[model samples]
Every structure is written in structure tokens, then in C-alpha cells.
Target: MNNTLLPAVDTNLVPVYAEIFLLIAASAILLIDLYLKGSRRNVTYYLSLLAVVGCAVLTFGDFNSGATVYTFNGMYVSDPMSNLLKLFTYVAVALTLVYSRQYVTDRGMLSGNLGGEFYVLALFAMLGQMIMISGNSMLSVYLGLELMSLSLYALVALRRDHATSTEAAMKYFILGALASGFMLYGISMIYGATGSLNIPDIAASAASGAADPTILVFGLVFMVSGMAFKLGAAPFHMWAPDVYQGSPTAVTLLLGGAPKLAAFAIVMRLLVEALPSLAYDWQQMLLVLAVLSLAIGNLTAIAQTNLKRMLAYSTIAQMGFVLLGMMAGVVGDDTSNMPAAYSAAMYSSITYVLTTLGSFGIIMMLARAGFEAEQIADFKGLGRRSPWFALVMTVLMFSLAGVPPMMGFMAKWAVLQAVANTGAVWLAVVAVMFSLIGAFYYLRVVKTMWFDEAVDTSPIVTPTDMRVALSLNGVAVVVLGLIPGALLGACLQAIEMTLRS
Candidate 1:
């Protein structure tokens, strides 16, 4: 009776090699950091960078293969979209660490009790993002979201002694918890309706009309509400501005950059993959969110004097365009336009993250110990302070404003085109009008930088690494805008492959 053999697990570790390696690397670095003295903190930083590079190396094959491979009992997937997004996540995390090094160090975030936690937590956060990007099941996506959110919460509160930082972290944690609860409840309802947590199974059930429509729609509403909170789309964007403005600039960058990609990935997985049958319902919801986000984000940004707060509002507006692209994917039960529409959303998210990195990098570079350059007036006469960085900042601002020959313009145009292609010409027109209104604030920043007199003309000193990285960041925006074909083509191919598989 005891001689019965258990069935062997059918598991492939190859698909998760990057995640395994990163988890090991982060743990090793955390332990290694405990032994290193203050001066040796750079070792931990380099190790984290090496870990990111290793992830890229491991994921490169998957990206090139252009094949979809599922593992972890179909909870995780390795596909062109996941691989491409993971690669970009690696780049974003690496650049974030590089840009944050001096900023964190100057504020003692890298020394004393904290000692290298910034880098360690960032790696952990990246691990979460990778999981989110590859998640093929609702449970896996939720797990990844919590991991990333927890790490970011700690990062925001890193400056524990600072009242604003502590308060901001608390606010973020509370709202984040609420969003997670909403998502969890939605998942439960969906599982009850469809009898599955597997995304593809849910999709098949929904497509077959085998699930309870009333419960499904209710769950979908809750799910979309949670996602909107995560994406900083309005009506659910109360936490973004305060969190953005209150966290340290370095932490603010951490909150803004790669996580957006992960958020977008999961949105696609849940809405496009799991609930395509409810396309009209969710599209209407997205339409409302897009309009509200555009209106609130643009109009509110005009009144913001704090640069971080303004950018937070700007992020909301940018996400509005992304929502537009997302909503246009399946127009009137015809999914012929899905690939182009979704790819455009993907491109908008990627480009927005690229531009956001440079914008925050400049803010950090301008800040010194005990002085955060967070005010709009802080940029007064910045062009005279350091012409190159000022020009870099200008490029970044132009990109955010969706001005011509910058990456943002291309991103906006792509989304608008996607919307119009769906016969939503009026929606596209509204978005453009909001874009025009948003441009005023961005141009005002430029005006302050070039035309205003200096308040504190101290030399703009920056680390060489940051200088070079920022330069490349700015150049990438302009270059990508001018020759947008390659990235856009890649996005389209990735989306096409993902949907086909």
C-alpha cells in the first residue's frame, strides 16, 4: 500500500532562470552588504547592476526566440512581450540605480542603518516587476504587484526621520493596500463566476459565454478600478501627487519608471487576455477614465508650482493617452485593429518611462545635501548654470509636452491614430486639446530655465556617470522620435506575437 509512487512534477526551470538568478543575487548582495563597511557600499551597488545585466543576458534568448513558453504550472509565461518588457525593466532599474547613487548617498540613505538597502530593495522591486510582466495567472500577477508595492513603500520611507517622507509612505501603503484588496475581491468574484484563476481559462470561459455575465461585469469593474489606481489614472489618482512630491527625488524616480511597464503588462493580461468578451463594457469605462484623466491631469497641472506634483499630474495625462490606446484595441467586436492599438499603448508607456527617467535625473542632479530642488522656481536660470543639462532638461520637457521631433510627440500621435482608427475621432480631438493645454506648463518650465534670473547660481556639479546617462537618455528621446520605426515595429511585432499565441 505504501509502495505507490507520486507523479513527478512537470516543471521547466529555464523560463524562470532570470528570476531565480536575480533572487539569489539580491539575497547574496543583502548579506554581503552587512559585512561591508561604509566606503565599500559601492560594491553592493555594482553587484546590483551586475544582477540586472545578468537578467538581461538570461532573457535575451527568450526575446530572440519569439516563442511563448509557459511554466510554473501555467502561472508564468515567457513570451516576446514579457521578454521585451523584462529587458526594458532591466534597463530602467539599472539607470535608476545609476541616477540615484549620488542622490541617495548625499542624503545618507546609503550609509548607517540603511546601508545598501536602497540597491537591495530596488533589485527586489525589479524582481517583482519581472514577475508581473511574465504572470499568466491572476494569482501570479497579484503576488508580483504586492512584492513591488511593498518594496516601493519601504523605499519611500527610507528617510524615516523626515516627516514628509514618512507621511508619504504611510499614504502610499494605505492606498496600495486598498487597491490590493479591491483586486483580490475582484479575483474572487471572477473565480466564482468562471471557476478558474488561470488567465487563458478565464478568457475561454468568457468567450464561450459560460461564465455569469452579471458577476463577471461586477468583478471587471472592481478590477479596472484597482488598475486605474495603480496606473495613476484619475478618479483613483489621489495618492500619486502627494507620494511623488513627498518622497525623496530618487525614490520618486523609483516609483515612476519601470513599474509603469509592469502595470501596463498586467492590464493587458487581465483586460485584453482574460476578458475580451467584455470589451465594449471595459472600453466604455476606459473612455471615461481617459477623458477624466486628461481633463483633471492637464487642468490641475496648470496650478501646480511644485515640479514633482506637476509631473505627477502630467503622468496622469500621459496615462490618459495610454488608456485611449488600450480602449481602441477591440472596437465594436472587431479585433482587427487590436495589434496596432495595443502596440501604440505599449510604445506610449515605454517612451513615457524613458522621458520620466531623464526628467527626475535632472531634478536629483540639481539637488544637494539638505536641499531638494523640487520647486518650479528652483530651475530659474538653470540654462546659465549648466547649459548642457539645461538643454537635456529642455529636451525632456519638450518630450513630455508632446512637441515635434521628440519621442512624446510620436507616442501621442500613435495613440491618437489608434483612437481615430477605431472611429473615435472625437475622443482623439479631445485628447489633442488636453495635450495643447498641458504644453503650457512644460513650456513654462523651459521659460523659467532660460529666461529667468538665477536665485542660487552655484555650479551644477553632477557625477560623471549621471552626466553621461542623462545625455544618452535625452538623445534617445530625440533619436527615437526622429527614427521611430524600429521601436514601434518591435512593439507591434511583440504585441502581435503575444496576441497570436
Candidate 2:
């Protein structure tokens, strides 16, 4: 092997320094946490939040306003899309730590029993997501995926004493490993055919009809299958419910929340960016996946008695809507509308993550010592006990149901509009129908909270900081629902910038 270094002047490290800072910060936190004992470990917790916030600031400051620029020999990249996604990721993660703080502390995660591993590992996972978001090449994408997956696998089993948590961790690790293998095999096939792992080169080869169609399509199959598992889409979604149900609520939120943004980025790279020439082929596959996801996710969610498990299924259905918007971009080589299509999906992805973050935040808030708060029955008297939280949960439920007067409605509407624009009316219709079906379960939760009598009669007490954060998080959902133009435009602009590059 030839050992060579790229020109110093040509390497653009400026754009990726946020991720580097995250790596250093996480390492420093790990070392600092080692010396802290008991509740004093809250210092590590605070530092984790600070680290995430600092990364957000760094990402914002370094947001490139120009075209795509490659760094690290073109393995890493900077673009408006990545910049915007990274910003959102930071927000999701910071908010996650806020919501999870009391929950973990109550559960012994902060008392030196679980050590500071949760915070440290979360920071590391955040780094992985940042890596995945900016990855420009196959090798980089694989690296990011493994890093994020490995962190999540550990997080699920953070409560090692719990049999369910340990079982969930094992299931997730096995499934995740298999998915990774599939993705790697697909990458190898593409590399074999194109002789390059760079996204742009693979795209060029496909566009020029230089790569063998059979090989390209076969690789795409494995790639999409792998992506389906990561995104928790149906037929490949077996791991989500078990993992969501068995993991601690705080860890569950981390698994379900910010990672969706990275998953969307992975899809964008693998499908939209690297293989636009094969859009027609993959679009059909996505269509099937979307329909199955909507059907299985919604109908199955209706049967789930567990709140976390229901949300797991809801995540699947929500991802279906995202896929609906994504596959609408390519209609017989007319890629002019690709930005709107991709951006609509991006908007949906971001909205779903934000809404899910708040919903799970509330779930964690409801939980107390020795109580997991994982059941629909647990929310029976939420309205009587905590009207503010009940209302917040209501907003999230309505949003997830795609009901009017909530951000979720606008998200679904935007994606449907994008799909309709591409002449996919049937797809939009299927989505709406499943969305209506999905509404039943969300409405059921609302009914339980507002109308049913108390099951436990426990008071919901939360910290001032958590209360304030939850209020702001809920308010953002409502405000964004009412005025989604700015965010919608931002999404469009980011994708437009990417398309230009």
C-alpha cells in the first residue's frame, strides 16, 4: 500500500472542526467524569449539554454558504444540507439530555452506579451522527454508521441489571450487525463495479451508463434493505418495537429522536446523491416499502397497548410519509422538482424528530422511581394531574396524527403536495388513509389522558429546568405548525444548494 498525504492547501478542515471538537469534548468528559462521584457526576451531565450546545454554535459559525466542498481526500464533505442537518441534530440531542437528566438520575444512571457512561456514550453517538450527516463517500458513511450503531447498542443495555434491557440490546446488536453487513456488501459491489467509493464518482459512472446495470441494481437492493432497517421501516422493522419497549425511556428517546436526522442524511447520500441516475429503479422499491410501512405501522400501532411500542410503530408510519415525498422526485428524467421533493422529505424528517423528542420527553417526565410509565393506562389521569403536560402531549399526539392546527398536519401536507406534484396521487391517497388510521391510536391516548380516571393517582413532579424546556419544546411544535414557511423554505434552500452542487 502506498502511504501518501494530500496537499495541505487542498485539505478543507475548516468545515469539519465541529465534529473534531465533539470527539475531543467527549473524550475530555469521559476523563473528567472518571474523577467525579455520586450526584457530583452531574458535572459530567452539564458538560455533555455544554458540549452539544458548543457544537451547535461551532456548526452554525462554520456553515458554508457556497457549493459542496470536500475535505479529507473527498471522504468528508460540507454543504448547506449537511450544515442545516447538523444544526438540527445538536438541538435534538441537547434537548434529549435535558429531558433525560432527571429520568436517568432517578434510575441510578447518575449515582455512580451506572457511572457517567450514558452521557459520555450519548456524546460519542452524537459525534457519530455528525459524521454520518457529513459523510460524502461510502467508506465514510460506513464508518459513521458503525460508530453510531455501536454507541446505541451500548445505550440500550445501560441498565444491565434489567433482563428486558439486556435482551433488547442483544436483539438490536444482532439485527444492526446484519444490516451493517448488508450495507457493506452493497458498498463493495458498487465499488467493484465503479472502481471508486466516492459518491460523486459512483453517480457519474451510473449517469454515464458505464457501470453494469445488473450490478448497480443488485447493490442498490442490499443498500435499500439495510437502510430500511436503520430507518425502522416495515418488513425490516422487527428490532424497533422490542428495542423501544425494553430500553429505558431516556435511552429510548435517544434512539428514536436525533438519529432519524442522520438516517435521513444517509438515505439522501445513498439514494438521492449517489444514485440519482438509478432513481426510477429505487423509486419503485421505495413505493412498495412506503405502502407496507404505512399499512403495517398504522394498523399494528392500533393494537399496541404499550406507549413506547406504539410510538415505535408510529415512527415507522411517519417514515413512510417521508419516503412518499422522497420517491416523487424522479419522473422520467425530469429532476427539476427534485429539490422540492427532497426538501419536503427533509422537512417531514425534521418535524417528526422534533415532535418525537417532545413526546418521549413527556413520557420520561411522567415516570418516577420504580415506575417506567410505559403504558397507555398510565396516562389515564394525566389531564387531572398535570394539565400543562397533558396539553403538550396532546399537541404531539395531534401532530403525529397529522391533524390540523398542528405542525404534523403541515408536514404531511407538504409531503403530499410534493408527491402530487410528481403525479403520484395514489401514493398520497394511501398515505392519507393510513394517516387517518394512525390517528385512532393517538386519539385513544388523548382520550385516556383527558377522559379516563386515574390508575396510579401519582403526582407528576418535574424539575424547573425540565418544565421550562418541555414548555419551549411543545410551544415550538405549535408555533412551527402555524407558521411553517420559514422552515419549509429553509429545507427547500438546503436541498436546492445540494442539487446545484
Candidate 3:
């Protein structure tokens, strides 16, 4: 009943202005496609790229103090946390376009059907992600999440004539719908209990130092279950492999990257911001999800013959590492250790996105007409035939497997150390053991490329744009792996901003 106690509802919208600009540009792309027709398709690409650069510039200008900036009557927020994630999403999507468009075009996935739809859909997806990042209320989070999910469903089925592509899209749509339902139901329950959807309001209400045990605990479980499925965690990971395998390689690349950052932001916003009083309950739930994800992801990846499917499982395992850091941060008895643990978790997320995108870049490189190159057998003797590609692939696989001197290794070390420091040594131990099991599958890719006999396969023609993009993507992983300080610093800065509030 006390309006004055609620969070402020007026602040500068400058931070999220980039999202607005992107919306305009996306509409322009679609219009251009409709009017100009066939020959001017390339114009859409150029405009999309320009929009991305513009958004990046806006994001750069937006970063400043760690103040919580309410926009649109407390529905949105703009702080260092949201800004950092928005910048990352921008960069990731830009890179995806640069690398993926040429492949999509080459495969006839972009012809005869409003060539700009992909760009438009991508913009909508980015909009959703931006909203999720700055969402101060449950309504905003769900709206943004649905926007992103709907765009992705259409994106996966862009090549509608293909049976596999349609199937993958359908599976994703069904699973996503279920996850959304769970999240919505949980939000309703929370609203019924507290009569509020604003995160800070929920926190303030619970800050009297106690929570309604049953309602809070069940709501937390439902929330976590929904987020786990979104992040492709175990027991909810069945869709990932099939979707990755069946979709076009370009779609798979998008599926594996940027949206993950959105997922992380949503979870942090809901759990840490809204339900701080119920930390102990969520901690145990996350630990179970993490353990199961690590076990299922690692053990199942070894048997996968398809590269896309293997990477899907690998993503599940990586999600476990993210959860491990989150759980450690929450469960740690020493409050002093929380910052470091959370930073580790956030850093792992950034590194995982970069490494996974780069790995998928390689797969996209080998993909050509009538030859999807989805199978690991396709990679046999790749080292002998294409030494440079093999070399890059080797680094990506090693990085994913958490091998030494790579960013993945550093990320794992950071999280596992935090888990150990929290006195969760058993969880840490299990993580390490599964990491080794995960390594075996990554090494198998290496073995096929290097040790196996070279096949007499036909020469695959690669587009110059894709070739250049793949090279940059692949090299970026190794370069970042060698010097992860910048990304790590960004992660720490973002985490500090989020928690210091």
C-alpha cells in the first residue's frame, strides 16, 4: 500500500536507446527487401551491419556509473550489469551475421522469401535479449523471453522445405513453450504471495529477514527448472542435440551462442535480485542440476557421431560449470568469497560463448551444398587435407575440453577453486572428474582430424566471407585463450556492479 517504498520510476533511457535504434533499422531492412526485390538483397546485409555498429557505439557511450537507472516507469533498468551484457550480445550477434550470412546465402536458405527476414528476426531476437537484460519486472522478462523464443523458432525453420530443419524447429518450439509456461506459472505464484512483480520490491518485502517457506521454495524450484531448461541443463536437455543436428549449421551457430548470455541475465535478475531471502533453498536445487548436467553431458557426448550433436552435449556440460560457480557463490559460508565466485561464473559464461561460437564456425566452414558435414567422419583426415583448419579446430576442441593454457581451463579453475573454497569439495571433485570424461570426446575429434587416414572426399568450396569470418572467429578463441584478462576484467566489473547494488 506504500507507493513511496517502491523503486523509483523515472530515469534516463539513454542506456537502452540503442535497442530502439535497432528496432528501427530492422524494420527498414524488411521494407527494403519488400520494395527493392532480388538484386538489392545485399543492401539489407549492409544496413544490418551498419545497425549493429551503431548499436555498439551507443552501448559504448551508455557505460558509466553503477547506478540503477529505471526507464519506462520501472519496467526496465540500465546499470553496468545490463550494459555489459547488452554490449556482449551486440558483439556476438554481429559476429554471427558476418560468419553466418554467406553460409545461409550459399545454401539457398536466403532466396525467394524476403531475403531480409533473417536480419529482421535477428533484430527482434536482439531486442528480446536487451529487454531481458534490463527487465526490472516479471512482465518485462516474460515479454522479452517470448520475443526471443518466437524469433528463434522461425529462424530454425527458415529452410522450411527441409524435413530436418522443420523437425528441429518444432521440437524447439514445443520445449520452449513448456519452459515458458513453467516460468509464467511460477511468476503468478510469486505475485499471489507478494502482490508484486518488481524484483527490488520482492527483495524489499522479503528483507524483513524471512520468507514464506513453502511458497518461496516452490516458486524458486519452478523458476530454476524453467531456467535450467533454457540453459539446456540435464533432464531438460533432450531437445538440444536433436535441434542442433537437424537445423542448418548457421542456425546451430546462433542457437549455441548469444542467447546464452540472455539466459544468464534472466536467471540472475530473477533469482539473485528477487529472491535473496531464499538462497539456501535454491543452492541445493542448483547443485543437483549442475551434477546431473555434468554427468549426462559428458558421458553422452562420447557416443555422438554428429559434430553438432556432440557440441550440444558439450554446451550442457559447460552450463554445469556456470551453475557450479553460481551455487558456490550462494552456498559459500564466507561472504568474502562470494564476489570472486560470482565473477568466475560470469567469466566462464563469456568464455564459453566465445569458444562454442568458434567451434561452430569451423563446422560451418566445412558445410557446402549437398554436404552438410554434420558427421565426425567428415572430419577424418581433415588435418592432412586442411592443416590450418585442423589446427584451429584442435585449439577449439582443447579449449572446450578445459585443457591447460586455454581460456576454458582458466574458467574451470576459477569456478572449481571457488567451489572448493566453499567447502563443497565433493561437487568440485565430481566436476573435475566429469571434465576429464568430457576431454575424451573432444580428443576424439582431434584424433579423427590428425591420426586417422585421410579420405578421398571431394573438394569443398568455401565462400570468401565465411572463410574470413571463420578465420577471425577461430583465431579469436586462441588469442583470447592466451590472454583472457580483458574479458575476465569485464566480467568482474559487471558482477561487482550487479551485486554492489
Per residue, candidate 3 scores C-alpha lDDT tens digits across 18-136 of 88898888887888777656656778777888898888888777665556677777778887778888887887888788777667777776687576788788888988988998899
- Using TM-score as the measure, the top candidate is 1
The TM-score that candidate 3 achieves is: 0.95
Encode model 1's per-residue lDDT on 189-232: one tens digit a residue.
99999999999999999989999999999999999999999899
What tens digits encode model 2's per-residue C-alpha lDDT throughout 147-211? 99999999999987899999999999999999999999999999988889999999999899989
Candidate 2, residue 340: lDDT? 84
TM-score of each: 0.98, 0.97, 0.95
Sorting all predicted structures by TM-score, with the top scorer first, yields: 1, 2, 3
Candidate 3 segments whose C-alpha is farther than 4 A from its true place? 1-11, 64-67, 209-211, 332-334
lDDT of 2: 0.91
Clashing residue pairs for model 3: none
The 10 consecutive residues of candidate 3 with the worst lDDT sum are 329-338
Off by over 4 Å in 2: 1-9, 64-67
Model 1 spans with C-alpha error above 4 angstroms: 1-8
The CA-based lDDT of model 3 is what? 0.83
Q: Top model by lDDT, which number?
A: 1
